[model samples]
Target chain A: MDGWLVDLVAKYNYWIYVVLMMIGFYAMIRKNNLVKKLIGMNIFQTAIILFFISTGAKKGGRIPIVDYEQALAGAVQAADIVNPLPHVLMLTAIVVSVSVTGVALATMLKIYKEYGSIDEDQILERVKNHEP
Target chain B: MNHNLPILVLTFPLLAAFAVNLLGKISKKHVAPWTLASLVLSSVASFFVLIDVLENGTFKYTVGGWLPPYGIELVLDPLSALMLVLVSWVALIATFSALPSIKKEMPGREHLFFSLYLILICGMMGLVITGDAFNLYVLLEITSITTYGLIAMGRGRAPLSSFNYIIMGTVGACFYLLGVGYLYLITGTLNMGDIARLLPPLYESPTVATAFCFLMVGLWIKMAFFPLHGWLPNAYTHAPAGASVLIAPLMTKVTVYLMIRIIFSVFSPQYAFLIHGRVQTLIVWAAVIAIVAASLIALSQRDLVKMLTYVVIAEVAYMVGGVWLGNTNGLTGAVFHIVNDALMTLCFFLVSSAILYRFGSTHFKDLHQLFRKMPITLCVLVVGALSVVGVPPTCGFFSKWYLLLGGIEAGHYGFVGALIFSSLVNAVIFFRVLEIAFSSAGEESVPAEISGSRETHPLMIPSLVVVAIALVVIGINAGSFLSQVIRVAVPSL
Candidate 1:
């Protein structure tokens, strides 16, 4: 039990991401307001981003920068440097999440103008009633 | 120049999208010409790329001269090459019809609409050709974001539908990203080829299996596969006629293409089919339900566009089920259906656009004596409907034949039953529409202003005629096409 606990604690980052993702997923599906749904989407994306970033971290590694003289000599040690690919990939993901948030907010603004409410139920009712 | 054909197919539209936006501000007249010219160039390049791929076999082009496993690469095999030609030509043909429809529907917004249209094309083209797993996600988001914008541009409840699509699309894309992240964590590589190479030894690992599940679920959501298809119908139905002609035909089809790519390219057939044997049967059953349910729902729709949206969902199930059947014939059917389905869906939507342009609505009541009023458009509609019903000498029949053959070969009788049931339901639904259209019962009820026998815009009918002819041509030549293209496209099992 003690060893199991240690192993669990060691991989707590994965656990945290899973929890965060579920929370976001639940809100995205269950939330009534469009804004709240968009917020849930943001949280969901951030969880994935966190997961990607965590994959790049090493216990005793430095940043992915290399010494010029060491790199030219072809003696750069891979283990000493953190994996930079995931971080680079996450940077792109962050940009995508931001763009998505931007588009979602714009659509929400239009929805409010058209339906006069951002709540899902109210909007649905208006749609059903054919109310302008 | 010959070797650069792959990247040229992508860059032409990507560059033109921005050029069109900027040029539109200078003069509205420039938008159509610029958009058409770029699409023409892209289509020509894509055709040449297909020829190149057919001649030389599969090849990869590294972005910026950086090799794979580090830099991005675009891989053009027989499969993606064929898809590129399909997407480029569909967008070109659709644009011919879209111009006049946009002028009628949203006059001043043509430039913005075409801009998004061009970017969406680039994104889909990129999605088809990119070999990097992460690159596919970025392209997928690009396609989704542009689609969200295009769908929102429609009138009445479109924004709400677009919002719903945005939420669902983001979840799907993020799930895909998470799956890729998991794979990267396990294999320390993001290139699909690299990951596939590393995956076999780790096939027994729980993480690999979990990643596969996440990836499949993500793609299923994107493709609107049955249970995850909530966003597609409303979104496509509410979209403007101009946009629906493009998005309805291509978006789900491209995502299905991605699913096949992942199954065959990122994970081998042995891993996807043999190792995950139980899941394969379960997915095929799920597909059966998707087809039946979508067909039934389509039968109940009052509006033409809404019914066709449900039909699109059912066609998606056909392709998904075909692939999950775990045999070469099934995969071939799925790939061929992607091509057939895209063209047929485009044909149907283009007809809808003409109808919407003529009468301002496609409700059944409004469509009374449509055959008499718009004979040319209605003729093309019959051709499309016939194709959808799996009538012979049309493209749809050939693909459905392959799918039925596949189902029988795999001994998945449920799938075969569902395909036949859906086809029968489709025939009934279409014949019902035709009966209403052919009858003169409600002729007096149509508005006097729309009572003429005039066809749609000259541009519109020609494009529709071209597509309708292509459907027949493709059907007649399915034998040669199957040998030359799809046979090569289907990975040897």
Candidate 2:
């Protein structure tokens, strides 16, 4: 049982990515409101952020750095090295995703103001009216 | 900075978006000229990069002086350079066309519109040039976000159309990011070159196959290929004329470029070719379905803009099918069509927008006998329509010719049938519009028609001229010059 728990935790990162992805996708597709959909998009993008960040996580490893004691003793090696590159990339991706979400939300607000409602169904109705 | 021009191509327009925003408060008059200047500068930068790549072979410039396999890299290969030129040239012409239509449609938001437009161009250019897979995601978001804004800027149903686009675009991007995550997990790299190097050894791995499927599906959605094209028609039809002209031409084609990059650069053709023949056959049949279904749907649409939107779906399938044919001729036709279709669609959108501006609506039934009032715009539409329908003198013919040759070479006579069917459908669709243009509606006095036409700003003429010249130039030189560039690009894939 103890070993089983450890195995689950070992793959904890991927499990979180999968759950978050499902939640985000459900929110985007199942919700009818526009702001809710935008929020869903945000959640969806953040799941990706989580995935990238978690991929950089290492088991029982310290931050990648030069330590004199470890080097002199020859105690440290590749096994304990943590990757910082994906963390940096995730930082950029997070920023970009947030910026895109902000723009999308702002556009949604504008859509609401122009149409007087934010419901997708109502907007579609009004659009049909406009066409005819 | 000369060797670094690809990065600068992205940076200049981003900076210009901000500059346009801050300066629009001082005076909105400079928005058009400022946008034009920014696009021209980008065009010049792309030209230099193209020349460098063609002359010196593939040049990879890593961001911040970091070498590839470790740091981010920007690749200036023949394919990217060709796409860069196509994107910037369309952008420049679209900017010119957008100016006049924008003034009439969203006079209050010209600055914001043009700013987003330039930023959209920058995102596409960046997406094409960057050799980093993760970087493409960032750039894709930039383009997708700006696109939502541009679509929202249209009147009436614009907000709804834009909202639908946002939902679909986000899902598409997230799907792509998920695929990127899968790739990173297996290969432990985000750079295309590094991924390419790592993937060869892992070609048969199930994880790699999953990643490939995920990426292809994501990109197919983004490109609006067949089944995934749900959000495109409304978005294109409801967008403002200016936004329609700018985006309809290049956005999906850039996504197609990304698909090519993922297929060729990240996963070498050797590995992809090794995939079971059954998979290739499945994809080819899917493309055929897209071609036939989209054309049939297009035939039923009454709105000209909406009809054109469906036709785009069909056209995308043509390229997708051609590429998946998995032969020299197929790949060449697909890549060449990428350029040809970009020009052809831009021409069509420009003329369509011109019609919208002059007539106040794009309804097929409403456009009776209005051709005499705006002869120039009508004539432009004629040429654009002819090109779109794959007429002999237009560039569309050559791409279709090559695609047909590709189909025959691949022994997929059904694909050739689909191609011919789509061309015929396109001909029927456009000719219906032309017939309407010539028909005599009840004599409404010329003054009212002129008043309706008065909404057009001077920029329309110049934008049409740019698109018209591009249509003819690309059509004529497609055989010798452009085909050669596509040829160079194809061998690398």
Candidate 3:
């Protein structure tokens, strides 16, 4: 039991990330409304962005930028700073996520205009009742 | 300067997209020439890169002058170089043919359409050439967003269908990003070669296993592998003919190429097979079902475009199953099929778009005696159909032959049976269409006499003829591709 608790605490961030991802995944697959689906997609993207950000964290590490005096004296230690690669990647991921959401919203507006409602079932029924 | 050719091949399209969009304000006529010139020039650049690869294998560079594990890398080997050239040529031809459809379907959206078209090309080329996993996600989004824009431009039900596509595509891309996050956590690197080296020790770990599942499933959804193929038919069917002709063939093939890259490049086949032996078996079984199920669904379809989309799904199953068979023959078949299927599907979709243009709808009932009216288009259709049915003297037979041999060598007889069954099913589907087209026009119920003019856009006949000739040419020369390129490129497990 103690070993189990220690293991859970050691990898707690991953556990939380998985739970968050499952929430977003569920909404994406199960949501009835198209806007809800778009929201789910954003949530899903955010979960991934957060996961990348989590990978950059290190205990007791400072900002990744090199200190001038420490660098000048050749005293900077690799472990003294957190890994910044994931952070840089996450920044890009955030930008991509924003772009996707913007496009998805625009697409949703088009759907709403076409169907007069964003509910998936309603739209499907309407399409069946009418001709493409 | 020549060493920078890989990045140059990719950057030119991205810049051209911007240039075309801006130039549209000056003169709308410049859009087509600008788009074609860019793709043609990039194809030239990519060909130089391919020649360079044949001379000195595997051109690799670090972007922005940073080292591996730190900067994004650009790579062009035989496989990616081949894909680069094939995609450029297909898109160029598709753009040339799109002239008629663009004016008819959505008149005012040409500039926007051409801009997104160029961007989509950039995304696919970048996806193939980029060596970093995160960079792949960004490129994937670029492809997805531009695709959604172009898909929404169709006349009827297109907006709704593209909306459905946006939801599914974003989910797929995010899942891939999540998988990349997991790898970065464990390997501390984003460069594919660097991660492939670091992943061996962790192959047995649950984390790596989960990551592999995410990546495969993500790509499967994007490629619309049979079960996850819900978004494909509607999206492709409703999209403008121009967009369908361009994206239908390349999008799924490029995604499948990415899957092969992940399985054989990033994970190393030994580790992937070790971890996914059972999963790969399951996937092969799933693929068999996909082959039979999609073919059956296709037979029941009245919409020619949607029927071909189903065929696309089954063809994807062929490539996916062949690669996972874990043999050199299977991998070769899979890679070869990507090129063959892309061209054949492009040709077919091109034919369908021409039909839509001439007749104003894709319903099979509407097109009778089409052989008499549009001989060139019908001939192009026949050539493409023969290939899809796996007939000899066409490219499709050779790839399916390799796939069958690989399946037999792997002792997967069920998959072998599936392949044969699908070929027969495809034969039935295409032959039925032929009979409908060729049967006496007197007996048919509807003549579709409204738009009976034989003068299809002057450009259409030339493009179709070119693709048809290329089909037979590729079939004749497939032996060279197999011996010279594919044999050397399949990475050893």
What TM-scores does chain A show, candidate by candidate in order? 0.93, 0.81, 0.91
Best by DockQ: 1
DockQ of 1: 0.91
How does model 2 score on DockQ? 0.64
Q: Per-residue lDDT of A20-130 in model 2, one digit per residue for the tens? A: 878878988888888888787788778778877777777897888868997899988866877777788778877877776777777777777776888878877876786
lDDT by residue (tens digit), candidate 2, B1-493: 3676888777777788888887986899878767878888888888888878888888888889888777778888999988998999888888777887888777778888888888898889889989988889888888888888888888776777777787788788878877887898898888898898888878888888888888889889889999999989989999999998888879989988888889888987776655656788788889999999999999999888898899888989988898888888888888888888888788778877877777667777667775866677777778877777788787788888888998898899999999999889888888888888798866553322333435355678777776777777778887776546778877554
Ranking 1 against 2 by TM-score, winner = 1
Query: Considering every candidate listed, which one attains the maximal TM-score?
Result: 1
lDDT (Cα, 0-100) at B199 in candidate 2: 87
State each model's TM-score restricted to chain B: 0.98, 0.96, 0.97
Writing each residue's lDDT as its tens digit, candidate 3 over A1-132 gives: 999999889988877877887888899889998877877778777877777777778889999999799899999987878888888888888888888788878877877777798899998899888774
Ranking by DockQ: 1, 3, 2
lDDT of every model, 2 decimals: 0.92, 0.82, 0.86
Better of 1 and 2 by lDDT: 1
Let me know the TM-score candidate 2 reaches against the reference structure. 0.93
Taking all chains together, each candidate's TM-score versus the true structure is 0.98, 0.93, 0.96
Fnat for the candidates in order: 0.95, 0.76, 0.87
Clashing pairs in 3: none
Candidate 3: regions farther than 4 A off: A1-4, B440-452
